[model samples]
Structures are given as structure tokens and as C-alpha cells.
Target: MERITERYRLAVRALGKFHELASRDTLNEIERDALIQRFEFSFELIWKCAKELLYVQDGIDAASPKKVIRACRETGLLSDAETEQALKMVDDRNLTTYTYDEAFVASLIGSFPEYDAVMHSWLEKLK
Candidate 1:
């Protein structure tokens, strides 16, 4: 069994958590914080799995999250909008590493649905 399958499985579990959190009308600071963390980890798995699959199948070497997403898009595994949204997720993940500001964190909450959509699409494609 390929590691990509396991990676995708973990990402999907994170995806479920993200969706559960997103569906809430309100989250306390702690829940919101956890949601942010889940998004970060999920996207990490998402891109790295994509990178692994690309390397295995096409000998494509995308060493970074952004590059792997673009490679996935170029190979037709993802659409342009999904690719662009994925890039923003990467940017958001980077932003989360350095801040605990509520306002900044709140802004990123909107990214969950978009991230979820694209990630689920990628999982289906991989399946």
C-alpha cells in the first residue's frame, strides 16, 4: 500500500473536523483555535500526498506546497480555482504559525469551506 493512501485518509479525517467546526454558528476561542490547527495539518497532508503521487506517477518533483498544488492543477487533478484557493490555504497556514490575534484568526475561518471543497475533490481524484 502506498503512503499516499494513508496520508489522504488522515487528511480526510482532518477535513471532517474542519467541516464540523465550520458548521458551528459560534466557536469559543479554544474551538476556533483547534479549527485553525486542523486546517493547517490537513492542508499539509493534502499537499504532501499530492507531491508524493506526482513524483510516483510522473516523476514530477514538487518540493513545496505551492509547487505541488500547481503541479496537481497542471496535471488536471485540480481546477484553476481550486489551485488558487489551495495557494491561499498555504498562505493562511503560514500566517497561523506566528499569530494568536483573534481578528487575524477570524479572517481565516472563511477559508475552511473552500479548503474543504478542494481537498475533498483531491481525495476523490486520488481514490
Candidate 2:
């Protein structure tokens, strides 16, 4: 339980930083890359937080991001629509690993607002 709480706190803090970067009106290449990195960090922490919370709160033991997300929906931490968006967020996070296409980067960054909103809502429910 303590571990779950700690993870949730960390996820919230990291998401706050991600939200700060995502809210910026304009970013150069370096800043854009930094935002993506922050997204990666925030995404990781949040999903893992969900995993831990599920285990501690609901006796669910999801082992992957997608699984954790689906479990979150089952636990009422996420709605069906938010779960779908989160799955897309997972795909975007994975894409950040190997792709450097500028167009894709722009599209991903443009998605930050939605991502940020859903993530925030999910975290709120986790508490």
C-alpha cells in the first residue's frame, strides 16, 4: 500500500512537469524532444502506478502498460473512452522509441492536451 501511494505521488509530480512542457505555445527541436522525454517518463510512472494500485487495491496484477490500462478501466479508474485514448497514448509512447519523423512528432505533440487531461483524470481516480 505504501509502495502504491508513493508510486502514485511520483506519477502525479511527473505528470505535472509533463503538463508544464506540453502547455508551452512553441518549442524548438530540443524542447520538443525534452517534452517527449517527459511524456515518456510521465507515461511510465502513471502506468506503473496503475499497476501497483490495482494490485494493492483490487488484487489485480497487470504486467504491462496495456494490461494495466485495461485493468484500470475494469477497476473504474478509467472509462471505456479514456481507456481507448490511453491505449493510443501507449502506441504514441512506443512510437517515440524508433521514429523521428517530424510530422509524427508534431501529431504526437498536438495530442498532449488530450493525453494530459485523461492522465490527470485517471490519476485523480486512482486516489
Candidate 3:
């Protein structure tokens, strides 16, 4: 079984990579596509970390993304704005996985900075 600490470290690493790509000033189609992919990965890691932390530290077994995010918000780990954004990201996660729409992809790419900021905040809190 993976320890929560180990899971957190992996989450942090994914978030860091997302930040690394986010800091870049320019990206062509492929790079932007890559960024979206990284966003999906980091997003998954973050919520999983949140779920694990809540389970191990708070005895709150939130099993789904919505449950975990809502619990985190209730515990003050996530803000209203962040909770809202996290929900949106969760929706996008599904879209990114099974569906491919340029508009959906573009919208998510455009939201990268905000998304990155939200994830960055969680990273700091986890640290």
C-alpha cells in the first residue's frame, strides 16, 4: 500500500511539472496540447492527494472527485472559487479523456493560468 506521504510527493511532482510548463511564454499547437495533458495529470494527482489526506488525517473517505473536492472545501482546504473551478476541471477531465473538441480544448488551455493558480495554491497548502 502506498503511504499518503508518498502519494503527496507524487502529486507535488506532477503539479511542479505543470508549473514548469505553465511558466513558458509561448506554445504552439502541440505544446498547448501537451499542457492540457499535463493539466489533466496534475489535476488527477491533486484530487487524489486531497482524498488521501482527508482519509488519513481527517477520517473523511471521499471517494469521488466531487466528494473529495466538496469535503476539502468544507474543511477550508479549498475556497469557493477554487471549489467552483475544481468542479469545472472535473467536467473537463472527462471531456479530455473520451472526447476531442477543439473549442473545449482551447477553452481549457485559455483557463490554464487560473487552473495553475488553483493547483499551485493546493500545492503550497499540501507542503
Candidate 4:
């Protein structure tokens, strides 16, 4: 498989693992932290795959979140609203990694379900 295809597969697998974690109703603090970390990691993986696909398909080099999301829109992979969401997600990803704020992490955790659903839908369409 091509690198982009491999990345997509990895992203899908990560998302699947995140889904498994989220489906459980009872989780300890450590489990919850792990789940959130998985969710964030999967989101980044999905975005990386999406950007790679765009690069392979259109010769577009998306170096920033806005550019990456714009590439997705230009390639018809995401609607305007989804692009907006993706941009926000990217920003949240950066913040989650760089900042030491619990509230930001909590907000990102809350967004995981939508992120997973959007990524899964896009992957299905791509396949």
C-alpha cells in the first residue's frame, strides 16, 4: 500500500480503538485519561491521513491546520461546516498537547464522539 493508504488504515484502527474505549460506561481516572489521549491521537492521525490523501491527489502541501482543512474542502472530502469543525479540532489538538489546562482537555474529550463519527464517515466514503 501507499504511504497515504497506510496512514488511513492506521487512523481507522486508532479510531476503532478509541470507540472501544468510549463504549465502556465505567472507567477509572487512569482509563479515562488513556481514553482521552487515544481519542486525541486518533484525531491527529485521521487529519494526517486526510492531508496525505490531498497531497497525493492534488499536489497540495498542507503545512498548517487551516491549509490542511482547506485542502480537504477543495478535494470535496469535507463540507464547509465539517472543515470548520476540523480546524477547531486541530486547534484543540495543539492546545491539548501544549497547555496544562484541565478544562481544555475536558472540552476536547466531549468532542471525541463527533470527531470519531465524522472521521469514520469520511473514511467509508474514501473507501
**Best first by TM-score, ranked:** 2, 1, 3, 4
In the order shown, what is each candidate's alpha-carbon RMSD?
1.3, 0.8, 1.7, 1.9
What is the per-residue lDDT of model 4 for residues 87-108, given as tens digits with 9 covering 90 to 100?
A: 7777877776788577876677
**Cα error of candidate 4 at position 25, Å:** 3.5
> Model 1 — which ten-residue stretch has the worst lDDT?
1-10
Q: Top model by TM-score, which number?
A: 2
The positional error of residue 105 in candidate 2, measured at the CA in angstroms, is 0.2
* Collision pairs in model 3: none
Between candidates 1 and 3, the TM-score winner = 1
Error of 3 at 62 (Å): 0.9
Per residue, candidate 3 scores C-alpha lDDT tens digits across 5-63 of: 78778888888888888878888888877887899899999898888888877899989
The local distance difference test score of each candidate is 0.83, 0.93, 0.85, 0.77
| lDDT tens digits by residue: candidate 2, 1-127 | 8898899889999999999999999999889999999999999999998898888778998899999999999978999999999999999999999898989999999999999999999989888
Candidate 2: lDDT over CA atoms? 0.93
**TM-score of each model, paired residue for residue:** 0.92, 0.97, 0.91, 0.85
Clashing pairs in 1: none
RMSD of 2: 0.8
For model 3, the superposed segments whose C-alpha errors exceed 4 Å read none
**Backbone clashes in model 2, listed as residue pairs:** none
Clashes of 4: 0
Question: Candidate 2: misplaced stretches above 4 Å?
Answer: none
Evaluate residue 106 in candidate 1 and report its C-alpha lDDT on the 0 to 100 scale.
71
Per-residue CA lDDT of model 1 for 51-96, tens digit only, reads 8899888899999999998999999998999888888888889989
